[model samples]
Target: MAAPPLLHRHFSNSLSSPPLHRHFTSSLSFPSPSMRPAALEPNLFISPKPSLNLSKTFASVSFENQRRKPTSFAPASHASDSEPESRENRVGEAREAVAEYLQKYGASREEANCVSSNCPSYLSMLIDGVDDLDGWNSLAAAAENVEFKRKVSQMAEQKGDKGVLPFLESIGLSLASASRLARYFSPSKSNALPRLIHKIQARRGGLHLLGSENASFGYLIESFPRLLVLPLESCVKPIVLFLEVVGVPKECIRNIILLFPPVLTYDIDTDIKPRLRSFEKIGVKDTDLGKMLVKYPWILSASILENLEKILDFFDEEKVPRSCSSQAIKSWPHILGCSVSKMKLIVEELSKMDIKSKKLGHVIATSPQLLLRKPQELLQVVSFFKELGMDEDAIARTLGRCPEIFAANIDKTLDKKLEFLSNIGISKANIPRVVRKYPELFVCDVDRALLPRMRYLIEIGLSKKDVGFMVRRFSPLLGYSVDEVLRPKLEFLVKTMGRPVRDVVDYPRYFSYSLEKKIKPRYWVLKSRNIDFSLKEMLGKNDEEFADVYIGDGEVLVPPS
Candidate 1:
């Protein structure tokens, strides 16, 4: 094969010279004075040398020559007046100069003029810094920047599409990126560049696939410009449809692609669908797939039986219930991508702290994300709770109830929860009791969950001290929503049941009862029978036990069918 284009070789040599002046004078010159040199005239092509202004350089030389001697060829009166005519002659000479140079290198008159008009900078880049020309085509292959030439040449070499180089450059692809993308595929495909460019234009609408945030579109393209060349129907569409079908919103699609562009290359049937099926088979619900993808889009492309099955099988071996298995893994599918050995390491770390298999499984089922976090981090959280005076057994229990506390900011969440309790007069000594009794309290938002319920209790006539004592006694009250649970039940107790404010303060556990199942039915039955029951009697007993004790051979009236 002939060596690649000399234009590339010549330009590379020229650009490597020490200074701007050396690029033109040292690397390039005219064959004869009759053939006007392109270097002395900037109009032939835009000079690549930033500092060498062609007209100024030539004019200064002309001025020095004029000072050295009077012109013998021109009459004395017209010598100075000939300057304007000389400039016009240079402009006329520029077009002929460009044409003659390109023609000498095998371009026809039309090709020469077209090349000059369209890419004026390209010829200067081609020959300005070049040296030691071998032949008419020598400049074509003389570029030291082989990578860029190879990229542009690959497109031009394709049958019927010599315009591909300029076409590609016209798009946003930089020459460096084009060269890199050229190497991303095989060299034998002479038609690859045209096909790639055609594919990009064919799927031009894919730009809109990045959704309302066009900013990510730039990022996605810049990150993986080659993705534009992927087969729209065969490659990109299947992955897009799979994600959309799985509930990844359109707005999130760009971010997913940005995070994992190789996902587009995954074989939809063999790679993507199977992994998706494995996720579903492992118990990740379709509804939760969106959440999973948002957090770890790479999971969609993870090896199914290799990665996901290892997690599911491990959970099975740990006796994670079949019912809870899907919920657990869906809670954090990113952990499914973690090496099983790393998961075992996490489990082993937890076990060292006395949180063993069953407890570990339960904690994982509730917060499988725990498997994503480092075992060391979890241990630190455990130590933090321990520093708060909780023993191993208490921490283990707290993990079972609120595994997310291990993931939360202990400084913010744990301190805030303790601080709220302290403010409510629960005392520093009693915080562990509150946490041990209700670990969920540490995870609940203090502004949203804790304050409103306590305030509602005071509104219903319990003193602040009495409400604080009730919370310390039954810490679960911190988990109930005031608008949903506490307020309605208190209204019923005060109005419907005619229970005095004093009675509720005395037995504040009344807030913990299921208002629908226990409070409403039992209270209705007792009230209808014209019998009175204390809050404790009504709430403490199961239905059968309450009926056996309170009804006393009279038919235990059931909740009205």
Candidate 2:
């Protein structure tokens, strides 16, 4: 089994505050510690930053325009004096109102049930408001392109004389755009026409003004005409408020709405909160969740149980350590949306290379995006390595060390990196051995990483032949950076120890050692006793072995201040 998380121990010992898990809050209102659940929901916590006043931002919604007469189904003329109406009676009345409205609109029974099933949220909006049917008109009349615009403009003016007509004209929506809303928001059926007008008012004054030339209101309305009819407070405001509360800037909300309009329709309590809680439980932190939502807003509408949780359950069943699983998911939340069948196919493909059970789970934990790659793409990466002379066993071993090779852009990226090595004079025959030893080199930039490091080696007095031999022996040197890794170690050896460049060039593997912990401390310990040692003699031993051999009868030098 893998060792326990170092993070948990480090956090507990170093910090006086509570654990990060406890610091998280539900996407609902911020609650105190006592009010929080025993195990807090994942990723739902608010930031430590001051909260924004979302109520003020959303206060302009005008519900008054939606007011109308009661339902067409009047109450029974002769009521029993003994019995009062109950919840069932209200539901029945609401159902009748929906049935009558659907009938008037010439909807088939199948169509009505399908529509009602798609929007379970409609019952709540229709509860008390179903009584008002005064605004209902003929579908054909309401769909008249000219009449719809004039009526919408009049409704817009009734609220505060906002003049939606001139605003629309100024913004210049094509006729197809106006015609789409006219057909979808007909006054002849439900109260959708008036509600559509109210929703537009909510968008004004915010950055998403219908009058703004840059606004995409025409595209959004044309794409999801039904969105205009959703109740502002019950259906739309909760989502907008939740997103704002989670720190999505107001300007980005319009783009999110346009991209994933169903976010406005998903039930805040039943659909959204539960899915977010599930994501949190899987170890996606609050900050990660917020960023993921803003980037891939469609995640809000994706099936949580089927897509996200199933993949996590697979990891748990395979005994991938929780911390590794958590970090991987946090890094790539979109992996959560990959279908279980696709993941199974990937696992099966990896099995072809003899990676199964615990090792498979471990590989996934290290680089979960491997599960997101197309099986064909993964096969191509394996094929490329095999074509370069690595057998399946060698490829599998290399993959164990750096499974992120699965994410490489094989045809383009690997080719470019190999071309760089060829240009640098590393013979083609030596390339496979170097690559097998350091597969991660394929994932790096040749210009930024490989060439610069090679240039520094030649500058330091190693011949091109010697440099190529060093890389063939220890391929990882090319992966090190000139400024951070190679240069600092070389500078320390030359300036501090007075070692000549020739001595350092003999063992390029010295660049791989930790300078402060291994090189500096060990050098000073040997120097204290006037003993000289090879690079292998000084650093090749394990810690306890080195301590016994070097500090046998003398005090080791303290680390320099």
Candidate 3:
């Protein structure tokens, strides 16, 4: 429903490709058409960038590091029985075998011949490397209906004239995918007219419920092309309806499905609810579970319960409360799937950094994502701060305050924010001060969020040097919205309060207080009493302290409506 990510039309171009369902590679590789079926097994999670790009720039994840192991369970699918023809072809035999395999698997002779003639290489690619029947059965199981085998047989009998090929071509599936999928429809591989009719029925019914026909359906279909003929009530509706029942909005169903189509394969009672309960037990409110799943749908699809228990044990061993890890997982559900051994490496690295074991749980809870970061990446932040005059405790505080900075590659976020500061006249020596003041500064977008605020301040009569000092003093001023926070507050200070804008150079924290709530009421309180106060002296005091000091304790002054 969010724009499709790579859609993997590239699946048809290369035989080594992962077909339609494999995870995106470092290069954002999508499965080619030939690979989609074999890809459906083993590789269960696909990290599509469109919906789940969630903040790649949060820190530095070398895109290479982003490539997850395909979580292979079956033997690998690359064709290896290379004969002298370059695993190429002996003219007749491979085609015969491919056509035979297609028919044995349910493709009719006519349909198989049509597919074999069109995509000989794609068909031939299967026989050598994969256990085609085993792979085909797995595809059959994905449809999950009692009628699946009978459906496959019926599809196999369709003559070339009546097959589902035209419907597939119209849907924009690649030729290899169409050819492979045409036979694979045990509801999965065939191309009967019934299958096309069912696809239309699904598009109008269940898929229409998912929100977009043009964009999301195309991506979803590519992942599980067989989903067309799957029993709507048992296979499709249950998953979509269960998401709604679990508090996922009707609109968001496609996002979870598009990110990991295997969520469709997971059984509602055994698989889906158990995973949902795992998070529920961890203190995830029922309302928040849908959001967490949307953020990381793999939470349901991946074999996470075993690893989740291991992580809970890790948290307990570290003396962190189970509740603490719950908060961590809410922020980063992917951590639920991380191995404890991999986590231990990170803990040991932090331990060597003089980070106390007592603080590990809280630190991770504050930024659950840090557990996924390589210790080297964490050290990258430490090494950077060490170079910047922060000691171990200082580095811990900086990273603990903005743990996202822990993985920020020196080449990107950390470096870019620092460069943005420099461009706005923040000196190199003063950057650590700015970071210490607001470590969240490292994560703000340089051009979009940070720079415009700085430019607005400088535009409003503060010299660039004044802003440099103010930012070094209160760097979060850069993070505030200009339309909402910056412009209105500056207007009040100079035009309404009649204070020099230079007063803000002395107290950038002026932007930190609410305008109508604190600033306006307090300023009018002081003004009615005919008293003057500096920006800091007026706004910095606690309400009782300010009242006791400025407004008499018993005095009732309604400042404004």
Candidate that scores best on TM-score: 3
Instruction: Estimate the Cα RMSD of every predicted model relative to the unseen true structure.
Output: 18.3, 18.7, 14.0
Among all windows of 10 consecutive residues in model 2, the one with the lowest summed lDDT is 1-10
The TM-score values for the models, in the order shown, are 0.59, 0.58, 0.64
lDDT of 1 by residue, 1-561 (tens): 011121123223321111111111212222234334322222222212122222221222222222122212221222346676763443333334544544443344554454333332222223222212222255546544443323222323332223332223223333333343334332333443334333433444454555532233322443444454455457765667778888998778766766656576677778776776766675667788787777666565444246666667877786666656677767665565566777787777777756666777677778777776777788889888888888888887788778889877777787788778877788777878988888888888888778877787787777778877887888887677878887798788888888787786668788887788678888987887888778888777766677787787645545522
Per-residue lDDT of model 3, residues 230-335, tens digit only? 4544666778888997788887787777666656666888878877787767888888888777766766643556666777878788778777787888877767
Worst 10 residues of 3 by lDDT: 52-61
Clashes of 2: 8
Ranking by lDDT: 3, 1, 2
Candidate 3, residue 525: how far the Cα is off, in Å: 6.1
Model 2 RMSD in Å is 18.7
**lDDT, model 1:** 0.57
User: Scored by Cα lDDT, where does model 3 land?
Assistant: 0.61
Clash tally, candidates in order = 14, 8, 18
- The predicted structure with the larger TM-score, 1 or 3, is 3
Which structure among the candidates has the greatest lDDT?
Answer: 3
Q: Per-residue lDDT for 11 in model 3?
A: 27
